[model samples]
Target chain A: MSVDLEKLLRPVDTPLPPYPPKVITLADGSKMVVRQIGRDDIPDLLPHVEALIHHERDYYDIVSVRVYAELLAYYRYRVVDEYVLIGQINGELSAIVNGRIYSPEIGMSYHTLGLKRGLRIGAHCFAAKMEYHIDVLKQEEVLIVAESPIGFRRWMIEYNLEKKFEIPHELGGSPSYSLTREIFNRARGSLIVGSRPVPQDLLDEAMEKILPPSDPPKAPPDFLAATRAKYDSTGTSIIADPKRKKVSHA
Target chain B: MREVYIVGIGITSFGRLEYPLVEIASYPSVVALQDAGLDTVDHLFVANMGGGRINHQTALSSAVLDHLSLWPAGSETIENGPASGSSAVKLGFQAIASGMCETVLVAGAERMSEVNQLDATDFVATLTHPMAEQIYGITLPALAGMFTRLYMEKYGVTRRHLAMVAVKNHGNAMDNFFAHVHTRVTLEGILDDRDAETNNPVIADPLHFFDMCPVSDGGAAVVLASKEVAKKLGKPMIRIAGVGQATDTHAVHERPDPTELTAVRLAAKRAFEMAKIEPKDVNVAELHDAFTILEIAESEEVGFFKKGEGHLALERGETQLTGKIPINPSGGLKAKGHPVGATGVAQVHEIVLQLRGQAEKRQVKDPKIGFTCNFGGFGNNVVCTVIKKEE
Candidate 1:
């Protein structure tokens, strides 16, 4: 069967928090710029999906770009209260974390996508999703699933998510675990989440316990470049706005 | 370190094996033990990098060891990408040197033919930096193509020079019964036969299918023993005079010079120094020739020729069977076939045969000193070993 090249190449847009939301400064001196997915952000999220599908083909049979485009379109117009978060360093889209509050009781199903180099930026995306799910969605519980043991386990331990139960072998073979609000809060005992707000401390402690000691942390070059580009663009947008210019002139 | 010698070496026909991966591995491991005249062994080190990816069989060492009924002898699997065979050799050497075991058996096997071409390419590319290179659609052949292009531009080496390495290896392979592609090709056959139906088409730019080694299924093994044990069990011996290994940066872009393999240089230097000999002392060399240009580049890196003069050496037939130094007397990987992990030990197996004067049709006469270089990934890690015929 002939493959549809465009369908294979199209990108998927991830869900994010509402734009211009209150920003939180992570303990590691990094700021979490949480915002909702937008039509304009489609271009920014496109390259990541393209790269992810291309890179992860060995692990998963990638869907067509048309499918991805359709998903993005569906998320934009049809999915209410669901959005994509583009995690940025400076202002670049280093990673994309998307999810929706499918139900107030059931919480959200979210996925994080980025280059391995952008893992740190992806962390912000994860934290943003967690914050949005916990505070914005205000759900009683939030659950996260990851294929890799290291990533999944780290998320569980970092966010105090409980290792509920592993999915059966028939479902993708890779294990899946969940965490509830009670378990998450218990794991974060005595350490106030909102008061401390040190993302680095949490990341470092989690990495030390979860990741192999010999393995060095990576900051993907492409992720940095994308984040820098986004930051530059955001700066330019603010400077060029007619309303902002008028205020400045006054 | 204690003195070590390869008392026995075993190699299956280096062409495609129709059997399963375990069967392919079993053949040589059994043969090596038989050749060494040992019914039992203390330790087993199996070298296979692709079995898991190709056949979805992880824990190959235990599988092979269990198949051979050599269970509970501290069997371990070693994987260092393509150079896995040599890495196993290193491990066996260390075991004997550390006085942990008096005798050790190391076997390397791979079955790449089972998978489709695209999947095989993806599997090999997994050895590269996942995010930087593989994600960017860079295949191993692409890297070889780039290296060939850069080497050609820098040294004024022509495609004909690269083709010469293929031609000579194929000619040499005509005598190597174990070689996969034995059909000899003329320079015209390479350059003019661009018709996709007739000729081996170029897989990557500047690299024809013929210029590349085949994705083969084969296995090879060698029995290592301490000098004391070797003397006692002596059938015929090839002393492991020296061994060297070195690693460079993982990413290609991080390398200082793409054309140069510093890992090879350092490994060879250490090997030669430990052997107390220079490159000229080596009578035969089975350097890693996964790609044709690799043979030329590795030759220069090992100090066989000046940086830019490797192509000239190949042009002059200096590396031919009857030339000053015969390279890949068992047709090398280019002709013999590269089963990834099996390649390095296969090289040693060929060298042992040459050193023992048992390489029937392709023997390097009066071969005294021999060498083998095993490269892992894209020159990221390398191991070089020097073997001398026992007087």
Candidate 2:
């Protein structure tokens, strides 16, 4: 536990340019602010991410667990050159995206976790992360991988990212895909979008505090409804719960 | 023919259900039977589209009948693409009217979520002319895109009009508990905003993401009985006053005018004629809106509005829940979630709900007569039905 041993254990962090804040209007006319968060802010976002570690649908469980670890590592100085960006709508956490600088010319995308569903919150935050690497930091390309099919469709197919199969990504050692500057430029106008210098009020609200998601994804009333239905054949498992009536927006 | 009344109805939540196809179909039948206070029906008709292809199951009616413990009751499976639900209902009507059965249970179910979106789209695309359309990679959306371009050029339907249909339906769906998409979207966000392009991305040119219906998994059932049987049941009688079906050229390009949904027109005309009521007399309607454009187009074709003026009526708010015609109070397929086979039956279920004054939040104003247009295969096949409540 000597100071020299502690110094040897912690990786040296690189100084990267800060990501400028931007605002995007979602499908429901809510404004979302995408801004980079320092390690100090990681605590406020951890509980929300941990809550989704057992979400059990749409690959949210795996993605949230990994993102939780990544955020924790960045907070504890366990990861090198990592930066976390969060999206907040009405000061509530809607999405989280994180990545790190791999080299002077390359970037590594860790994960994009959308706490809110159906409004493309994840997509906007993801574009901001890419913009951070290519537009701000001036990286040539970013290495990315998707843990969910929805992520794959949004990033790999939507951007037409090139394969970097030889390089295993840090998450799961999956084969990586490279989103070059050319690809980002091609998708800028249509896919990647946001207005820079976010409105003062919106930016201030986002920076105020990370509120709990008003309508987070919920575990089903019965986790094993399908399996139970298979065995019971009475179709009782599919019955509607008397208490839980409405599905909240994602 | 005799009078055939829909004595009881039930439907599953139209979304990504996590049960077997038989259970999906049978659950509604059980509910319908309970609603009718009947232990059995003389026959069961199951309507399903993708059972064999997606679920790897065949003889769906047999399985559903056995699952529901309606043993020895004659059962049959019906498939007519998206029109399968109404087709099965039409056959049930025929059986009751022809005195072949005292009562008939018709249930339509589709578990399209068993496969991914691409595979489900491909399976639905198989309804197209295989040699001409399917071979050329023609999905329903692709055909709809081409048709939309022609409709836009010919009738001046714009993207704004399409978005209006989506907005109206989604708003209507907010009140429908069974609707797949409960998310409320605004014109400012989906159309006019700087991020509208990404918020409502184009699935097909002239047709954005909101313009198309979500693929769903669900079931719906209606118990059709003879007038005598219906009277004995002591439930509100919603008679299937008319049923008409028509088919057009299999290949969309083969039609003389790709913009015209001639089958919808013909089928609706015949249904209205048989119902002894003009389109104006119908209190409410559930038009097929697999795509938002179809709502506008089918509205005109079904005689709710003049051709080329549907959008104008839409502009005037004529098809809203409180408007002149009040279309798709259950959000149609656009927001209700189209489980292909379940769509037609679900349409009937909605109409029945409206006629019985059971639709709570999204109910129309004292609807006495309700109509449904169940479109199949890019308007190649269509089934139209009219239902009226007996006073």
Candidate 3:
């Protein structure tokens, strides 16, 4: 008789309720369907997140790298009680948000990555994540942290999240912030959006496939553009490369 | 006076540009010089605001002149609140038409993005009256909000009218590559939909988020020359037919009628008189739509419509790209991105593009006459220019 070691190495995940899908009408009058995805769909989401790992603006590289790792860990049964949600606009993946249940009364917030840049797709998805933990799962609070200034503004400042400094977030050693039920309730009307009972056709379209994002953030064509934006009071960098043909006037 | 013509024009993308302020002003100068096939100008006028406070750089004209390598040319910086861009253009015209200079280059630029939003807002708020307005913590949006409410009460201009202006300008900006806002907003999305409240929150009372122009960093330049120089260039003959400026009481409460933009009316009247044309003769226009309500108010004040009926024309789609006397075919300041200093010159640039028939997709139908209204300090100071294309 031989003893099996594979079963003992993996941590068993606690059963959790599924997040109901909802639809949001974007500022451009387009429909976005947000729904929960299972572990099997993680592979389908990695390529898009992986592509953003090289983008240098707004800390997209760090956030995308962590999101890719989180997706991989969830897929390989390395993490327990994890949930993934995606937002799709016309069958195209627009954003990805994920988290994990720490206990019956607590949740651990992970990441919110918006594939589409300007239309506030990430803000809506992050709202959906908060809704999942507090409204759906009935947790008391969700511990959150932001890796970018955009995320900080959306989560900490917008929601007025309370400091959970004593508790360190899993992403890093930084002190965590807690989005208590009281805070979520206070910021509910303005920050939270989207309607329930999504129409069948729209839901079916989002479920059919997770197409690539139409226009995702990318590396700046001219590296000096970023350099000049951050520092460079001398103005010599631009003058030295006048004929570079990358002024971005258009 | 001799005729002053715009021989060349150029602009940069109106958004978050990550370059030095002088470089921002210099790039467009280079483009305009290349367009006109000129190596230098007799003089240069740079329009800028917030250079000292926001960017920690002053003497912008000296820096830009040196940066462009145009040493011998005289340079000056003009500051007139939001009207700085057009004021520079006006001075450039005066220099050429008065025979003080044969050629002048007018460049305007702003880099508001270098600072945070609150700081930028405060920087702009400094434009208000110090003793009367600033003491009360009044900002531009607050002033616009009060003006919009009065316009609504007196003129029956509803939120729907404002949304229409935003929708129209946003749609027009999609075709403008250099515009700041490329997102297309719908009536349903911004006003009618359930998510509208969240998507378009109230920034100032009665003025929604979309009703105001964005804080942008951009640059624009125009080369003004005498008629003889214009003839030799072989470019489109876009002559600056008229330039008129007028001022009003600095404090808003001092105005005879709070609802009226008297300076706009006076400036437009003088511009039309000097040009020997009426409002109806204008083929296209670019009004200073820093706030959506201003578009309606200025349209009426400039004699495009009855004092209280600009909204009616908007309802009739008379201000659309295909409508009669199409307004802001270059998206106006609402969507084109208002870089305070660059805005006035940018308006002239669009008018020149229209007169030259070079506005690719948003070009008006054979426009021969173009009008621009550059408003400053809540209409206390305004500059109006009328341009014509000669055969």
Candidate 4:
């Protein structure tokens, strides 16, 4: 028989418990169903991720590109032990979060992308991922890294994650931060929100179709706007008049 | 004194603006001048609070004058805390009415987002008594929270009543393209839902996250000129009929009646006397709702409703856009975003928009008289203005 190259190319996934689906009552009083999705649903999610690759604000471009690649790898069986979860508001995609099992005691955090932002949709999804690894899968720690300032504030600072400087992460070569079980447990009550056994109709609707995000983040209309912002080198005035050339540094 | 009319009004969107502080001030100046069909003014007054401390710029009016390319005219910066916007307009009114200037441009701006939220809060807290309040870490939210508690106890105002104020203003903002907060909040979202606790946390107990006005970056301007100058422009005659300002205790605790906004009552009385009109004559108003409670308290203090009955009037659908007396047709500070220095002028700008019959989607029916109360320093310094649209 010819050598089985396909078997060598695909890594075998370890059997893991499925993440229980939950529903969160959003600030708008609307119920959002957060549930795990299998590889078969990757085709429906790819277009949304691809659409956000060109968005230049708040690091969405970088995060969405990597997410697209990760989901594609998971679909093709090139990667092992991967999971995906999405927050859907009224059957519309509001946020997407994903991660993978590195080992029995360690977890790899991938990305958290909130399509409908300003309501902390990303923060809620991120909390669910940590819950999945620590509470559901019984992992000791989850390796995390923030690709955007918003993410850094939400995950690292909010949760007070520990820096595992020596351990390099898969997404970026930089050292990964560790969200230990202790840290996850401390933030669970307040940050971690959602109820088990998402209602039948809501679950059925979320799985039936993945609708496009109603409100998506957009790139700033003008980069010159940021350039015009005065940079206070020494707390001095950044918008001093040209005639006043002797303006002191902040 | 001669009659002073506002012939032009202009404003930038009240939100996180990316332009420089001076540009934020000058952008509205250019628009106001264009609206009035004038290229120059006899004087320019720029209203700002933290140009030096927050934006690291000083002598703002001079910088703004130069930035707008309007040199040689006299200019000065007016800093009166959050009331700076109306204080600048009051000065402009005096300049035009006293014949010191035939035309004047008053522009107010604040770029609060330059600093982080903590810094902005601290910068605003500086308005409180340094020794009495600041040393104890008393932010505006804390002060509003205490005031809300007392008001709730005495007036039977529930959290639902406050949420109603927020819901109304947010609904009003949905139609205002220049407003900062476009989010539509419902009573269930902030109050009834189980996630309401997390969604709208108690920022300072008794007042939730939705209760306070957002710190914003924006600019607003009004062109005040003599009646003759106004007639030459052929625009609607929205005269600055009256401008009244009053002061109260610097420390909120020092007042005998903590619930009473004395400055608001006195200033409104003075404005009404000057304008020869009662509160009932006003068809529309823009109250300083830096906190949702302020709208209820101020409405009563200004005689819009009997004391302790403002919330009831709100419940009666009286403050809506199509109600008997529409309040905050421009969304007020709650949803419109309070760029502190620009807020008072923005309030007056909305009144002008109403009097000119140009407040498109949220326009009140034939609003010939409009009112604005710009509260500053937690009611310590208050300015009230009455505007009339002449036939």
- CA lDDT of each prediction against the hidden true structure: 0.70, 0.89, 0.90, 0.88
Q: Tell me the docking grade of candidate 3.
A: acceptable
Q: Give me the runs in candidate 2 sitting further than 4 Å from their true place.
A: A1-6, A220-231, A234-250
Candidate 1: list runs displaced more than 4 Å: A1-250, B192-198
The chain B TM-scores of all candidates, as shown, are 0.97, 0.99, 0.99, 0.99
Residue B205 of model 4, lDDT score = 93
**Number of clashes in every candidate structure?**
25, 1, 0, 3
Model 3 sits at an interface RMSD, in angstroms, of 7.4
Q: What is the lDDT, from 0 to 100, of the residue A5 in candidate 1?
A: 57
Lowest-sum lDDT 10-residue window in model 2 chain A: A241-250
Candidate 4 CAPRI grade: acceptable
Q: Model 4's DockQ?
A: 0.24
Better of 3 and 4 by lDDT: 3
* Per-candidate DockQ vs. reference: 0.01, 0.30, 0.35, 0.24
List of clashing residue pairs for candidate 2 = A117-A250
**Which pairs of residues collide in candidate 3?**
none
Share of the reference A-B contacts seen in candidate 3 = 0.38
How do all models score by TM-score? 0.61, 0.95, 0.94, 0.91
Q: Chain A structural similarity (TM-score) per candidate?
A: 0.52, 0.89, 0.88, 0.86
List RMSD in Å for every model shown: 24.7, 4.6, 3.9, 5.7
Q: Residue B389 error for model 4, in Å?
A: 1.3
